[model samples]
Target chain A: MPGAEGPVGPRTDGGLGGGQRPRDRRRHILGDVFAVVCGAATLVGVVALAILLFDVVRDGVGQVDLAFLTSFASRFPERAGVKAALAGSVWILGLTALIAFPISVSAAIYLEEYAAQNWITRLIQLNIANLAGVPSIVYGILGLTVFVRALGLERSIISGALTLSLLILPVIIIAAQEAIRAVPDSIRQASYGLGATRWQTVSRQVLPMAMPGILTGTILALSRAVGETAPLIMVGAVGFIAFTPSGLGDQFTVLPLQIFNWISRPQDEFHVLAAAGILVLLALLLSMNAAAILLRNHYQKNRN
Target chain B: MVPSAPDLSFRSGRNRNERIIGAILFLCAALSTLVTVGIVGVLLTQSFAFFRQVSVVEFLTSTQWTPLFQDKNFGILPLAAGSFLIAGGAAIIALPTGLLAAVYLSEYAAHRTRRILKPLLEILAGIPTVVYGYFALTFITPILRSIWPETDVFNAASGAIVVGVMIIPTVASLSEDALSAVPDTLRQGAYGLGATKLEVSTRVVIPGALSGILASFILAISRAIGETMAVTIAAGNLPNLTLNPMESIQTMTAYIVQASLGDTPQGSLAHQTLYAVGLTLFLITLSMNVVSQWILGRFREEYE
Candidate 1:
C-alpha cells in the first residue's frame, strides 16, 4: 500500500520495478544452471568411481574362486591365486591392530580425560597431527632404517606390521580422542560421585560408550593399512612370492604389491590379473567397512 | 545406615588398582610419543649418512637424476618438479569442483540428497590408489592420447586427473563439514535483510566458514602432495625435469619406490638419497598439518 502512494513516485503497472522482472528471471536461470552444474559434477565423479569398481569386479570376479582363495601364486596367470596375499593381509592387519589399538586408545584417553591444560599435552597433540600428515613412504623409509635394517628384522611381516602400525597410530589416536570427547561429562561426574575409581569409570563407563567409535576408527585404519603399498615396499615386502608365508618372520606379499607387480608387467594377461586383484582388495575393504558401519549403527541405536 | 565398618580397605585396594591402570595408560602415551621420536631419529640418521656423501647443494640444485648411470647425477629437482606440477594440476582440477559439490551438499541439498551424495562421494576416497593408478594408465591415458597424439603412454596428465578424482571426496567431505558448521543465526539475519538464498549462502555462510574451508583446502593439498601409488603407477618412472603434463615424469615418492625395488646397493648414495627425500616430504606434510591444526585451534575458539 505504501509503495502505491503518489508522493513516493509515479504509479507503475505492477508493484515490481520495471527492471526487477528481468533480473529475477535472470537469477532463476542462473540458479538452475548452477544447480545443474553442481549436480552434474557430483554425478560425474560418482559415475567415474562406479566405473572403476565395475571394471575391477568384472575382471576380478572370474579369478576369485575357491582355488584362487586357497592357492599360492602360480607361474601362469590362469593358475595364480591370492592365498599368500590374503594371509599376508590378515597377518599385517592383526599385528597392526594389536600394536596400534592399545597405544592409540590410551593416548586418546590421556589427552581427553586426564591431561591438564598444559604445554606438554599441547606439544603431544601437535606432534600427533603432524605425524598423521607424513607420507606413507616416509614411514616406509623410517621402517627401513629403524625396523628392517637397524633391528635386523629382515623382509618379514613384523617389520611391515610395525611400520603400518606407526603409520596408522595418529589416525586412531585422533579418532579415539574425538570419540572420548563426545562422551558427556555428566557420566564421569556420576561415576566419581559413586566413589568409583578413575580407571573403573573410564574402562567400564566411558570406554563402553566410546567402543563403537573406536572400533570403527580402528577398522578404517586397518583397512587403510591393508591397501598401503609404499611402506611395505620400503620394508622389503616381496613382489612375487610364489609360496605362502609360513610364519611372521617369513617374507610376504600383499594384494596391492601383487597388483603392482602384475600391472607393471608387459603382458596384457597380467593386466587382467591386476584387475582381478583389485576386485579382491575392494571386497576385503568393503567387508571391513560394512562391519564398521554396522557396529556404529548398533551403537547409535543403543546409545539413544 | 551407620555403614558400620567402613569399606576403607576395599576402597584403598581399588585405588591401588586404579593407580596401576593409570600408570599403564601413561606408559601407552609414552609409547605413542616414542613412535614419533623413533621415526624422526631413524629418518634423520639415515639421511644424514646420505648427505655426508652427497652435498646438500648437489641434492637441491642438480637438474639431472640418473643415479643408476656411471656418472651418478643425484639432483632431486626433476622429481620435486614433477611432484609439484602433478599436485598443482590436481589441485586446479579438484578445488573448484570439490568446493562446488560441498556447497551443494551443505547448503542447497535436502537431507535425503545429502545422505545419498555423501556416501557416494566417499566411495571415491575408498577406492585403492593402485586401482586409480591402473585407471589412469589404462583409461585416462588412452583418452588423452586420442586428443593429443604426442602424449606419452605414461603421462603426468593422466596421473594428475586420476589423483584429482581420488582427492575430490576428501576435499568435498571436509569442506562440507566446514560449511555446515557455520551458524544458522547469521544466515537468518542475511535472509531477514532480503538477500536471496544464493546470496545468503555465498556471502554469509561461506565467510563464516572461511577458516574451516581454508583448512580443508590445506588438508587436501597435503594429501595430494603425499600421494604415492597412483602417481607411481600412472606417471612413468622417468625423472624428467620437464613441465609438460603430457610427458612422463616422476615424483619424490616414485623415486623412493624406484630406489627400493632392490636395484640400489645398500649404503650407497642413491639409497641414502631415498631417506633424504623422505625427510623432505615428511617435513613438508608435517608443517602443513601443524599449520592446519594451529588454524583450527585458533579459529575454533572464536566460533565457540
Candidate 2:
C-alpha cells in the first residue's frame, strides 16, 4: 500500500494547485483512499492464490510419492493412488493434441489466409466464438450423445478425447488465427514474389513463424482439457477404474475426476486425498504454463 | 530475342495440388460449423424427447426439481435460481474488485510492477476450477461456517467466493486491456487540467472503456454461471429454491454432472433431463457470449 500513491511528480504548485481549500484536502484524501482500496483489491487475488496453494500443499504434500504414482486407486484412503487417473490424463492430452492441433491450425490458416470477407466467413468466426463460450458440461452432453451412444464408443478414452478436442478446438482456432494473422504479410509477399503458391508460402514461411504462438495456445488449451472434469464425467470417466487404460476403447478416469470423487466422499482422509490430487493436477498445469511462457518469451525476444 | 521463350508451362500438377490443399483446409475450417450444428442437434433432439414426457408448463413452472424421487417434479426454477445466485454473488464480488484492480494496473502501477503483477493474476486464472472447488470446500467453507454457524457444509457462498476468485483474472486482464486502450492523451489532458489521478481514472479512463469493461463483466458472469466442477463440488446437490446463500443449492451444470454420474438407462426420462438442462444452460450462456462479443466488437471498432 505504500506505493499506492504511485510515483508522485515534484509538487508543481507547492503540493496542490489549491492547497488552502478544504475541498482540495478532501479530494486528495479521497484520491489516497481510492488508491489504497484499489491496491487492496489487487492484493486480494494474489493473497487468495497464495492461500489456496498453501492449503493444498499442507494437506496433500505428504501423500505424493512414487508409490502414489504407480498404484491404482483404492477404497482405503492411504492406498488410493493416482496412477489410473494420471495415465488417463496423459492419454487424453496426447490424443486431444493429435486430434485437435492440425485441424485447428488448418482452420486458422483457411480463415486467416484463404477466406474472403463474406458472411459465411463471418458466421464461421461467430460460431467459433460461441463454441468457445459453451459450458464444458454441454460439450460433455454432446460427447455422451454423439460418441458414447450414437457411435458406440462406450465410456472409452477415445470418446473423452474427442469431446475435449471439440471443446478446445475453438480456443486453438482463435489463437492460431491470431498467430497466423500476426505473421507479417511481407513474408507472404516475398514468398509469392518467388513464384511460390499460396499453400507453399503458408506451409514454408507463415507456419514456421507462427509455430511458437500456436504451440503456446495449444499447450494452454490442452492444460485446460486436463483440468476439465464435467465434460469427462458426462463422457463417462468413472471415478473408480481399477486398472489403467490399455487402449483407446477402455473406460478411463482423469486426475480431476479422481479428485472430485474423493471430495464427494464424506470421509476426512478422502478430502486430503483430493487435495493431493489437486497438487498433482496443479503441477501438471504449472509445467504446461511455464512452457507456454517460455515459448512466448522466446518469440518476443526474437521479434525484438 | 527471349531465348526461345522460356518453358513456362501451366504446371497443372502444382495447381491441382494447391487446389486440393485449399479444399482440405476449407473443410477443416468448416468443421467448427459442424461442431456447432452437432451440439444444437443433440441438445434439441434429446430435449424434445424430454419435453414430450414432461410438459413445458410443468418443467418451467414447477419449483422443485426432484426427478429422481418417486413424486417427480420437473420444474427447472430451483436449478436456474441456484445458477443465478452463484453467478450473481460471484459478479458482486468480482466486478468492483476486478475493475479497481484494472484501474490500478493501468493507471497507478509502474511498468515493472504491472509486468510482475499481471502474470501473477494470470496464474490465478490458469488454475483449474476443480482446485478452486477443493479450496472452496476445504478452506472457504470452514471460514464461512466459523462466522456463520448456520452455513451448510456445501453452501452457495463458498462456491461463489471461489468462483469469483477464479474469474478475477478474467475481469482484471480484460478490463486492463480496455483501460489501457483509452488513448494516453485523454489522461494527459485531464492531468493538464489539474485533475487528480482518481478523478482521471474514474471520470476519464473508465467512461472511455465502459463498453469493454461491461463486456468483460458479462463474460465473467457467464463463466460463473457455466462453471461446473467448483460449484458442483462446493454447492451441494439439493435443488432448493431459496435466496439464502448459507443453504446448499444445485446449479443447472451441477444437475448435468449429477445426472451423468448416475447411470440412467438410455431413453429414460432422467437421462433426457440432462439434455434439457444442458440446452437451457447452453442458451443462456450463448446469448450472454454473443452480447459480450457484440460489445467487444463495437468497442474495438470505436477505437479503430
Candidate 3:
C-alpha cells in the first residue's frame, strides 16, 4: 500500500522521462541485494542450529539406550550411563520448582497489587532487574560461600537447588509479574464490590487468571536451572559420584555436569558419550519448553 | 451510607487476615533484595580475604594467573583479555547478522514466514548452553581444525563462533521487537517519500529503534562475556594473555569452572580467588546491564 504515488504524470515532454535514471536503478539494485543479504543473515541461525542438531544426533543417537540411561558414569564411554546425573537433575528441578514457585509468584503478586508507586518501589524493581542480569557463575560463588560454607549445607542437592532458585528467582518474578498485570483491574473491582478482601480478590480471581502464564514461565525457568552447571560446580558438585542422590542432603550430579566432564576428556569416545548426554539434556529442555508453549497456546486460544 | 458504616467492624477478622497475607507476600518480594545483598556480602568478604593474601596491585598488574600452580601469579589480565577476545569476536559475528536478521524480520518477511522463523529462533535460543558447548567442542572445533590446520584442541575462535551463534537468537529477537515497536506509519511515510524498502528500514526504522537495538547489543555482549559452558568447553584452561583466537585461552568464567572442578580447601587463598574473579565479572556485567537498561529508559520514543 505504500509507494503508491503514481508514475510521473505521463512524460508530457517525453524523452524516456520515467525510465532513464541510472542512479535510481542502481539504488533499487542495491536495495534488492541488501534484502537478499538480510534473508541470508536470518538463515545463519537456522543453519547453525541444523548443523549442531545433526552433529549431535549423528554422534550420540547410537548411544542412547536403556543401559546408557541406567548405569552410573564410568571411565569407559561404552559402560558409562546417566543414572546418577538424571536422578540428580530430577531432584534439583523438583526442589528448585518447589522453593522458587511460591516465592516468585508471591513476589509478583506483591509487586503488582500491593507495592506503592514510590522511589523505594523503583529501587527494588531496579535491583530485581540487576539481579536478573547478574551472571550465573557469580551466583555460583555466592552459593559456595553462603550456602555451602556459611550455612554448612555442604555440596548437596538442597544447596544446589537453593542456589539455582536464587539464580532464577528474578526471571520467574518478572514473568509472573507480567502475567499478573495482564489480569484486568475490573476483576479486582468486582471482587471488592462483592465484599471480598484484597487477599481474597487476588487469591480467588487474579491468581487463577494468571496461573497459566506463571506456570509457563516457571517451567521455562526450571528448564534453565536444569541446564545450569557452573553454579552447581561451584557449590561442590564436581565429585565423581557413582550413585544417584538418595536424599536432598546427598551429593549430586546433573546431566550438563556429566556432559561437561565427558567433553573435557581427550578420548573421542568420551566425546561421544558427551554427545549422548547432550541428547538427553536437550530432550529434557525441549520437552519442558514445548509443554510451556503448549500451555500458553491453549490458554490463549481459550481466551480468544 | 450510614447503614453500611454501622457494620464496618464486622469485617475486622478478614481485614486482619488480609494484613497477615500481605506481610507474607511482601517478605517474599523482599527476598530478591536479600539475595542481592547476600551476593554482595559474600563477594566482598571473600575478595577482601583474597586481597589480604595477594595485593590489589599484583591482582591488577601481574601478567600471570597461575594461582593453582606452585608459581602463583594473581594478575587478572589474562582472564580478562580472554573474555574480551571472545566477546569481541562474538560481537563481530552476532551484531551484523543479528541486526540484518532483525531488519528482514521487521521489514521484509511475510506474516507466515515471521511466524515460522520466530519460533525457530526461540528454539535456538532455548537450547542449553552446555549443548552449545558440546557443539563448539565437537563440531566447530573439528571444522576449524580442518580449515586452519593450526587451530588448537581448544581455541577462542571456536568458542567465539559458537557463543556468537548462541547469542544470535537473542540479538535477533530483541532487535526485532524494537524494530517492530517502531510505528507502521513511519514506514508508510518513508515509502511515500519514494524510499526503497532497504533504505527505509536502514534510514528510518533502525534509527527510530536505535536505543533498543543498542541495548540488545550490549546485553548480547554481556551474555557473551559471562557465557560459561560453551567457552569453557571450546576455549581451554590455559590463561594466555594474547589476543590470538587460534590459541587456547581461559576466560574468567572458565577459571571459576576450572577452580571449582579442582579440590581446594575452604578459606584457602586458591579458593578465595574464585570470588575475586567472580566479583570482577559481576561488576562488569552489572554495569553493562545497568547502562543497557538506562539507555532503554532514557531514550525510548513513546508513540501516541
Candidate 4:
C-alpha cells in the first residue's frame, strides 16, 4: 500500500529515502518503456505501408505508359497491359453508380424523411444492415444464378455490374442515410412553413445541402466496387483477354482480377506485373477516397 | 384578369410535375428493396437445387474432395476444415495486434501521432487483397520457409499471416472508433480516484466500449472468412484436412474459384457441390453479421 501510494504521487525529490524511490523510478521507467514500445509498433505499421506503396508505385508506374493504358493483355508479359481491365472497371463503375446512386439515395430519403416508424420501415432497415454484411462471394452466387444463368447474360459485364451494384448498395444507402440525417430539421421546417410541398423542400433545399455528403458516400462505395475481386471472379471474370470489351455483354476483367491472374502464375516477372497492377488499382482507390474526403470536408465546413 | 388565370394554370402544372417526381423517388426506394429480395431469392433457389442433387451427409462428411477427378469424392469437410483453420489462424494474429494497436492509438498516442497513424493504417486497407496475395506468396512465404523448412511454398501459414495483415486496418479502425467513444468523464473519475492511465483505459474505457469492440472483432472474422484472393493465391488448391498450418490447404472460396475456372461441366454433381459449399459459407458469414448487428444494437452505450 505504501509503495503504491508513493508511485501514484509525483516524484519531487530524486530519492525519497531509498527503496521506495527506486521502485517508483522503476515504475516510471517501465511506463516510459511501454509507451516507447507502443509507439514503435505503430511506427512499424506505418513503415510497412510505406514499403508496400513504394514497391507498388515503383513497379506499376513503369508499366503505366501510354501503351500500357491503351493496349490489351497479351500472351507475353512484355505486351500485357491493363487496357481491357481498365475499360471493364470503368464500365462497371459507371453502371454500378448509375444503378446504385438513385436507388440508395431514394431509400435513404424515404427512411430518414418520409417513412413512418413502423414495422415495415424497421424490416427494411434490418434487411439493409444484414445485406451490407453478406459476403461479396454470396452476391456473386446470386448474380451467377439470377443474372448470368437465369437471365442468360452469361459472363458479361452487365451481370458483373449488377452484382457489384448489389454489393455496394447497402454501403451507399447507409452513407446516404447518415448524410440525410445530418441535415438540420430547421431547414425542413422553414420550407414547410413557406407552403412548399415535402418534395419541393427535399429537392430544392435538402438535396442541394446534402449533395456533398451524398456524393462522398457514392464515391466511397464506388471505390470499394473498384477493388472488389471476389464477386467479379464468382460472376466469371476472364483470366486472360486480348481485346477490350466492346459491350456489356462481352467478357471482361477488372484491375483486381488482372492482378490476381498475374500473381497466381509461377513466373517471377508476373509478380512484378502484379505489383504494378496493384499500384494502378491503388491510385484509382486513393483518388476516389480523396474525392470522398474532400466532399465530406466541404459539407462539414458548410454546416459549421 | 386573363394574365392571372394563365399564371395560375402554369403553377398547377408545376405542382403536377412535383407529384410525378415524388412518385419516381418512391419507385426508386422500392427498386432497392426489390434488389435485396432478388439476391436472396436467387441464391436460395440455386442452393436448393444443389442440395437436391447431393445428400447433405455426403456433402458435409466426406474427407476427400476430388470433384474433377475420375474417382470423384464429394466430401466438403476438408475444404471447410481448411477454411476454418486458416481463418482461425488469421484471427489469432489479427485480434491481438489490431486490439493492441487500437488501445495504444486511442489511449496513449499524442494527437499528432494518431493523425499520422490512423491514415497510415488505412493505407494497409487500401492495398488490394490481391496485392497482399502476391506479397504473401513472394515475400512472407519465403521468410516463413526459411524459419520452417518443411513449410510448403503454398501453405496456410503464409496465407493466414497475410490475411491477418489485410484485416488489421479494419479491426484497428473500428476498435479505435469504439475506444474513442468512451466518455472522458470516466477517465477523469478514474484519475480522481488515483487510478493510473493504464488502469483507467484497461478497466473503464475498454469495458465501456466492449460491445463495439466485440462487434469489430466479429466483423473482422467475417471479413477473414469471406476473403478469397489472398488465400487462393497463397494457399495451394489442395483441400487437405490437416491441422498443420505449414501445409497446402483450400478454402470454400478457393474451391468455388477452382471449380469455376476449370471445366467442371455445368449441371454435374461437382458443380452442384460448389453451390453447396457456397451456401455454407454464406450461412456462416450471414449469421456472424446478424450477431454483430444484434450486439451493436443491444449493447451500444448512448451518451448525451
Candidate 5:
C-alpha cells in the first residue's frame, strides 16, 4: 500500500515534475540509497552493542582479576569487589531454577498432553500468556507482600529466588510447552501401543525426546532471571552487602543490584567499578546464552 | 488423536502413579492462574486502601507526583508523562530502524546471512538491562552532553536511546516473523514482474504483514513502558510533568522502586502508593499486550 502509486501510475509524478527517463534514473538512485540505509540500520544495534562492550572492557579490564572476583563490597571503590553479589546471583539462579524447572515442565506436560481442550485449559493457557507479559516489577510487589510479609521469609535470598521463580515461570512454561508440543505425537502412540501408561509415555519417551529443547529453554529462562534487577530491587536486594550469603535465609545482593548501586554513586572510581561489574554480568549472560544456542543447534542437527 | 485412554493392559500400580502425576501436573498448571489472582488481589486491595486516603479523582486529575515531599501530593501524571515520553522516544527510534531491519532480513538476506544475523540480534536481547542502564548513564549521556552541552547527566534522552537499542531486537525479530509470514508466493509474484527489491518489500510484503508489524510496534512500546532498571538509573528519580527527554524525570516503575527502597512504614500512604502505581502500570501494559496479541492473531494470514 505504501508504494502502490509507484507501480500503478509511475508516470503521474514524472508527468507533473520531470521527463520519464530522468524520473526513472532518480528512482533508481533512491532505491539504492534506501537499500544501503536499511542495511546500515539493521546493523545499528549490533554496532551499538559492540561499542558498549568495547567501552566497558576498556574501563573495566584493569579492575578484573582474582582479587576483584573474590573480594566483597567496600567503601573504597578500589577495594570493592562483587563477591557478595556474585554469590547471591548464583544462589538466586540455582534456587529459581530448582523451584521453577520441575513445576514448569509439569505444567507444560499437563497443558500439552493431558488437559483436554476445554475452557479451563484455555483459561490456564491465557493466564500464562498474560502472566508472561506482566511487568517484572509487579511480581516483586507480590513477593514483598506474600513471601516477605505473609510468609515471614524476610528479605532473604530464598524470598528473592522465589520471586524470581515466579517471574520466569511463565517463560519456562511457554518454552517447555513449545518443546513438548514439538515431540512427535506418533512417538506417544507408539509408547501407548507398548502398553505404557500416560506418565510413562511422557516421562520415558516424550521428555527425553524434548530434553534438549527443555534445557535450552531452561538456560534462557535462567539467563533472563539472572539479569533482572527491578524485582530484586523491589524485593530488597541490598545496595551494599559486605558478607557473602551462605544459606537461603541469608541477606543478599545480585550483580545487577551491585552495578545499580555503584552507578548511582557520584565517585568516578565507583563508575569504573560498575563498568567492571557489568563486564562480569555480561560474561555470565553470554556463557548462558552460548550454552542455549549450542544445545538448540545440537538438537536441530540430531533432528536433521 | 490420543486414542481417548491409556492401554488397558498397563499395570494397576503404574495406572495409579499416572493418575497422581496427572493430578500433580494439573495443580502445577493452576499455579499460574493463582499468580494472576495474587497480583490482582495485591494491587487492588492495597490500591483500595490508598484510594480511601487519597481520592481516585485527585489521583487521576492532579499532575503533581510528590508522594515523598512534605506536601505529599500523590498524583501520577508526572510519572505517566515520564514513562510515556521515554516510551514514545524509544518507539521513535526503534520502530523505523527495526522495521527496516525486518524488511531487509525478510526480503533480501540469504539463508546463511539470516541465520547468523538473527542470533546476533538475539545477543542484544540477552544482555542485561542494568548494563544498558550503565551504558545510558555513563556512555550515552556523555555523548549527548558533548552534542548539546545542556543534556542532564540523568536525562530521559539517554535512557530512551539505550532502551530503544535494547528493544530493537524484539521489534526486529517480531517484525521479521510477520514479514516472513507473508506468503513467499506473493513475493515471487511481485518479483515475476519488473518490481525492484525495494518495491516488492515496501508494497507487497510490508502491506501484507502490516497487522503483525503494527503488533510488533505495540509490543515494543509496551516493553518500553514496563522497562525499569535503565529508566531508574538514567532517567533520574525526579517525578516531573514534562515531555522533554533532555530533562530528568521519574517513571512509574522507577517510582515503585524508589518508594519500596525507602523507609516508608507499612500501611502508610507512601507505602500504599507503591501498589497504586503498580496497578496503573499493570493496566497500561496489560491493555497494550492484549491489543498487540489480538492484532497479531486476528489479522494474521496462514499459508502452507
Candidate 6:
C-alpha cells in the first residue's frame, strides 16, 4: 500500500511559467494522487501474475512425477492423475490445429492476396473481426448442434476439436492475415519477375515468408484452445474418465475440465490437486507461448 | 472468377493448378460465412422451439433461473443478473487497472522495461481461464475470506478479480496502442506549455485516444461477459436475482454448460434453453463487437 504512491507522483513539480498557479498546491496533490492511482493499477497485473505463478508452482510441484502424468482419474486425491485428460487434450489440440490451420491460412492468403477492395470482401473482413469476439461458449452450442447431434459425432474428440477450431479460427485468420500482409510487396513483384504463376508466388514466395508468423499465430491460437474449458464442457468433455481416448471418435476430457472437476470437489485435497493440474496446464501454455515468442522474434530479425 | 491482375501468371504452365488453388482458397475464405450462418441458424431454430414451449413472458420476467430444477422456472433475468454482477465487477477492476497499465506502458516505460513488461503481460494474457479459476477457488477466495468472513468461496468477487486480471492485458495492450498512437506532437505541445509528464499523459494522450480507449473498454467488457470457465468455477451455479457480488449465481454461459454437460435429451426443454442462452450471449457480444468496430473505425479515421 505504501508503494501505491509510486515513484512518479509529481514529487518534483517545476514552477509553471516561473510562477505557481493560484491552485498550485491542489493541482500538485491531484496530479500526484492521479499518477499514484494509475501506477498502482498498473502494478496489479504484474503482481497478480507473479503471485499466480508462485502459488501454483509451490502447491503443485509435488505432483509432477511420471506417475501423475501416466495415471488417470481416481477417487483418491493422491491417486488421481492427468493421463486421460492429457491424452485427450493432445488429441484435441492436434485435430483442432489440423482442421483450423489450412483453412485459416488459405483464407488469409485469399483475403490478403486475391480479394479486391469490394463490399463482399469488406463484409468478410468485418465478419472475421466479429467472429473473433464471439463468445467461445456460443461456439460450444454450434458444435453441440452441428457436430454432436446434427452431424452425429457424439461426445467425441473430433467434435470438441472442431468446435474449438471454429472458436479460434477468427483469431488465427486475423493473425495470419496480418502476417501475410506484412510481406513486402517488392517480394511479390520479384517472384512475378521470375515468371511465377499466382499460385507459385503465393505458395512459394508469400507462404515461405509468412510461415514463421503463421506458425506463431497458430501455436498461440492452439495454446488458447488448450486452456479453454467452457466450449469443451458444452461440447461434452467428460469430467472424469477411466481410460484415455484411442481415436477421435472416443469420448474425452481435456486438462482444463479435469482441473475444473478437481476444484469443484468438496475436499481440500482436491483443491490441491487442482493446483497441480493448473501447474501442468501452465507448463503446456508457457511452452507454446515461448515457442511463439521465439518464432515471432526470429521473423522480426529476418525482416530487419 | 479469375483475379484481373495477372502479373504473376505471365508464364503459367498448366494453369490448372492455379485455378484449383484459387478455387480452394475462395471456398476457404467462404467458410467464415458458413460458420456465421451455422451459429445464427442453430441459435434461432432452438430459440424458436423454446419460445413455442415456454411463454416469452415467463422466460423474460421471472427472477429465477431453474430450467433444470424440478419446478423448471425458465426466467432469464437471474442468469443475466449473475452475468452482469461478475462482468460489472470485472469492468470495475479491469477498466481502471487496464487503462492505467496502458497509460504507463505507452507514456512511461523505457525500452528495456517495455520489452520485459509487455511480454510478461502477454504471458498473463496467455494463461488459461481454467487456471485462473483454480487460483480464484484455491487462493483468491481464501485471501478474501480472511479479509471478510462473509465472503463465500463461490462468490463473484473472486471470479471478478481473477477475470479482471485476465482482461488487464486486453485493456492495457489495446488502449496502450491507442494512447501511443496519439501523435507525439500533442504531448510535445502540452510539454511546451510547461505541463508535467502526468498532465501531458493524463490529459493529452488519454483524451486524444479516447475513442480507441473506449473501444478497448467495450471489447474488454464483452470479453468479460462471454468468459465462462473462471466465472463458472468462482461464481457458483445458483441463479437468484441479486446485485451482490458475494452471492452464488449462475451466468448464461454457465447455464449452457450445466444444461449440456449432463446428457440432456437432444429435444428436451433443457437442451433448447442452451440455444436460447447461446442466442442471448451471441446477441450481447455481437452488439458489443459492432460498437467496438464502429469506435475503432472512428478512432482510425480521426488519426489517419
Candidate with best lDDT: 2
Q: Candidate 4: where is the Cα deviation over 4 Å?
A: A1-30, A58-62, A293-304, B1-23, B301-304
A1-304 per-residue lDDT for model 5 (tens digits): 7654443312233343645577567666776777788888889988988998998999888999899999999999878999998999889989999999999999999999999999999999989988988989999999999999989999999999999999999999999999899998899999989867788898889998888888899999999999999999888889798998888899899999999999989988999999999888988888887888888788778766
Q: After superposition, how far is residue A216 of candidate 5 from its true place, in Å?
A: 0.6
Q: Roughly what TM-score does model 3 have, to 2 decimal places?
A: 0.95
User: Comparing only chain A of model 4 with the true chain A, what is the TM-score?
Assistant: 0.87
Query: Residue B92 of candidate 3: its Cα lDDT?
Result: 95
| Regions more than 4 Å wrong, model 2 | A1-19, A294-304, B1-10
DockQ of each: 0.45, 0.59, 0.59, 0.40, 0.51, 0.55
- Compose the digit string of candidate 4's lDDT tens values, residues A1-304: 5443343322324343555556656656665665566566566567667766666677567777777777777768887888888888888989999988888898888888777788877888888888887877778878877888889999999999999988888899999888888889999988878767778888888988888888987997898899888888878988788777888799999999998988888887777777877877887888888878887788778867
lDDT of 4: 0.81
lDDT string, candidate 2, B33-118, tens digits: 99999999999999999998899999889999999989999999999999999998999999999999999999889899888899
Worst 10 residues of 4 chain B by lDDT: B1-10
Write the number of the candidate with greater DockQ, choosing between 1 and 4: 1
Q: Which portions of model 1 miss their true places by more than 4 Å?
A: A1-19, A298-304, B1-9
Sort by TM-score, best first. Answer: 2, 3, 5, 1, 6, 4
Better of 1 and 4 by TM-score: 1
lDDT of 3 by residue, A169-216 (tens): 999999999999999999898887887778888998899889888989
Clashing pairs in 4: A60-A276
Question: In candidate 1, residue B47 scores what lDDT?
Answer: 87
User: Root-mean-square deviation of each candidate, in angstroms?
Assistant: 4.5, 3.7, 3.1, 4.7, 4.3, 4.7
lDDT for each residue of candidate 3 in B246-286, tens digit (9 for 90 to 100): 99999999999988888888789998998999999999999
Interface quality of candidate 3 as DockQ: 0.59
Query: Candidate 3, which segments miss by more than 4 Å at Cα?
Result: A1-20, A297-304, B1-5, B301-304
Comparing 5 with 6 on lDDT, the higher-scoring candidate is: 5
Candidate 2 lDDT tens digits, A72-149? 999999888999999999999999999999999999999999888999899999999999999899999999999998
